[model samples]
Target: MNVVILSRQQAVERVGYSLGLDGSGLNGELSPALVGQALRRATSILAPCARYELERSVRQTLQPLGSPGDVVGPMVQDVLESLIVYRDLLEMRSTADEVWASAEVTIRPAAPSFVKREDGSIAVLGTAGDVITPIPEDLPARLVHRGALRLLVPTSAEPLAPRLQEFGLVELSEKAWLRLPRVEPAGNYVEEWHRRLREAPIGNRPEGLLICKPTRRGTLYRDRWNPAEVGETGLFVARRPQRFGANLWCLVDLQPNSTARIVDLFSTGDTLRSCDVAWQIQMALDARAGLAQAFRCRPNGDRSTIDFFSPIPSWAERRLFLVGRRQAGTGCLYSYEMATTAADGERRFLRESLWLVEQN
Candidate 1:
C-alpha cells in the first residue's frame, strides 16, 4: 500500500507545529501544539519517517521528541517511529490518555447481491440467513486485564530451578519471584492490583505484569481462572496476541498510533488457547475487512470531497499506522499478534479475535 503526507502548509492546518514536543499538549486545556505533536507522531508512525529492526531502538529515539513542555519531545518521536512497522494493516496499538481495544470479527461471507443497510451496516440476506445478526450496538471496544494470577515462588538455593529448566524457563539472573498472593474475580480487580503496586512500600518487590490464566483444564470461566494456562510455572513466559485474522484477510487498525507491536498466534477462533509473538506482521489493511468497516474507514463524506487522492481522515493530521497481510483473492489463512504502549508506560494488548476466511 502507498501513503502520502500533506505538505508544510497543510501540515500547519492539519497538524500545526511544536517545539516542546513533550510539553506541547500538557496544559489543562488542549492546544494546537498538543494537537500538532499528536499529528506528527501519528504521521511518523502510521506513515513512518523511518523504519528500524528493533522497536526498542525506535522508542529510544522518540523519548526525546515529546511535545513542548514535554522534555521528552524528540525522544517520543523516535519511539513512535520505531513502532511504525504496523502502519499498513491499521493494527497500530496505542496507550495514550485512554486505552482503546478493538478487533475485526469475520463471519462467513454471503452472496454478492447482499447489500448493506442505509446506515452502513451489513445484514444477512436470506430468510435462513436472517438468523445472522448485525454487529452489536454495545460491542466491546476495549480489552482490559480484568484480573491476574499470582503463584507461590519457591524460595531455596536451587529452589524451583529444576522445574524452570524442565519448562524451558529463561531465568533472569537476579530477579526475585514474587508470589501471586491470590486470585480475585474479574470486575475491577486489575485496577486494584495496579493501585496496590503503585503504593507498594519501600523494600517491597514485584516483577513483571501479573498474568492471569486458567487454573483447571476443563470448561473454563472468568472467575475460576487457571494460572497454568496464561503464566509460566517455569522460567519461560508465553506471550500471546489479543486478536487475529486468517490467511486471506489482513488485520487493520481503526485508529493509528505510534509505538505499536504486532505478532502472530495459533488457532482459528476467538478462544485464547493458542497465540504467540515472533512472527511476521501483515503490512496491508484490506479495505473490506470488518475492522475497516467498524472504523468507518471507507469514504463516507460528501461526494464532491471524496478525495481518494488525499489522505483519509484517519491519516490526515495524526500518526497513521496498520499491520496485516495482502494476498490475491480470498481463502487465505494467517495469524497475527500486536500490542501498543504510550510514553507514560501505559500498555495495550491486542489478542487475536478470530480467523478471516474470505469467501470466493
Candidate 2:
C-alpha cells in the first residue's frame, strides 16, 4: 500500500505551496509562512520517512520496474519519492469544531450495511433489509461523549438522524440510552422494556434514522456486519490506486476538547465502578491515531467517510483543519454510562459510551 507520508519540511512546504507562499498558486490573504507553520503544528501525526521501508515496499511491489521498457517507470518513481507529501495532506476527524448534546442511542446490529448513495450521502442498509438513509448530518459532534460499543463494517444501509425528543427516545433530561432488544425473554423485565421501545413509533417520524424499528430480519446477523472483523479496531493508511476492491475501516476519536475539564481520571471515578478499562487503554491510542489522521492522510474530494468511533456520519471532507486554536492531542476521554434495571432488580445491563473529542 503506497501511503503518502512526508517529512516535517515537506508538509510545511506543501501547505505553503497551496497557500501560494512558495511562489505557487495565487497569493492568499493569510501569511504563508505563518499559516504553514500553524498547519504543521496543527494536530496530526505522520510516520517517519525511513529509506529502508520505502525502498523495500517499492522494490518488491513495483513489478513494472523490472520490465525492459517501462514507460510509466519515471512516474512511479516520482510517486515513490513523494509518498510522504500526499499522505501528509489527509485530514482524519471532522468533529474538531465543537460538541452538541443529542440523544445517544445504540441499536444492536443483526447485519448493517453502509452504502454510499449517489448524492455523496451514506445510507445504512439495516439487517432487516430496510434502508435508513442519510445518517444525521451532525452525528459526530453529538457523539462527543458517547462512543460506540463496537465498530460496524460498511453494509448497504442508510441514514438521517432522528429527533429523539419528538419520539420519546430522549427519556431523561441528562442523556438517554437506546439499545434494541436481544436474547432477553419476552415477559422478562428488560425484554418488556425493549419491547415497549420497539413498539415506539420512532422510526416512522420524519427525523427518524435507525433509531427505532420493529422488523426482525433473517439470521441473527447474516449479511449484516462482517462478524469476522467485529471488535477489530485498527486502521492503516496508504494511497491505494482506487482499485483496492473493498474499503478498510478504522476507528477515530471524535471526542472534543471541551469535555475534558469535566471528565479526567479523577472525575469519572467512584468506589464501585469507575471509568472503563477499555477507555483507559484507548485514550493514548485515540490521541495517536487522531493526530495521525489530522496531519497524515489524503482526501479525495467529497467521499463517504465513516467515523469509526461512532457509526454515524461517514463524513464528507475536502480538508479538515478543525477551525480551532488548540494543538493536537489535547482531546480527552468522555464516557456516559447508561444502566437499565429489571423490574425485580435481579437483572441489569450497563452500557458505556467512551470518546475523545478534539478541543478548540
Q: Which candidate number has the best TM-score?
A: 1
Give candidate 2 regions above 4 Å deviation: 1-56, 64-67, 71-73, 78-360
How many backbone overlaps does candidate 1 show? 80
| Candidate 1 Cα misplacement greater than 4 A, ranges | 1-16, 19-58, 65-89, 92-213, 216-237, 240-360
In the range 1-360, model 1's lDDT, one tens digit per residue, is 888764433333332224222232233333333332343334333331112212234344443333345544344333332222211111222224322222232112121112221222221111112211112222212111111101122233323334433433333221111111223322233233234334433321111222222232222223332222322332111232223322211111111221111122323332211212101111002121222111111122321111011112222111111121111122112111112212111111111111112211
Please, what is the whole-model Cα lDDT of each candidate in the order they appear?
0.23, 0.23
Worst 10 residues of 2 by lDDT: 316-325
TM-score of 2: 0.15
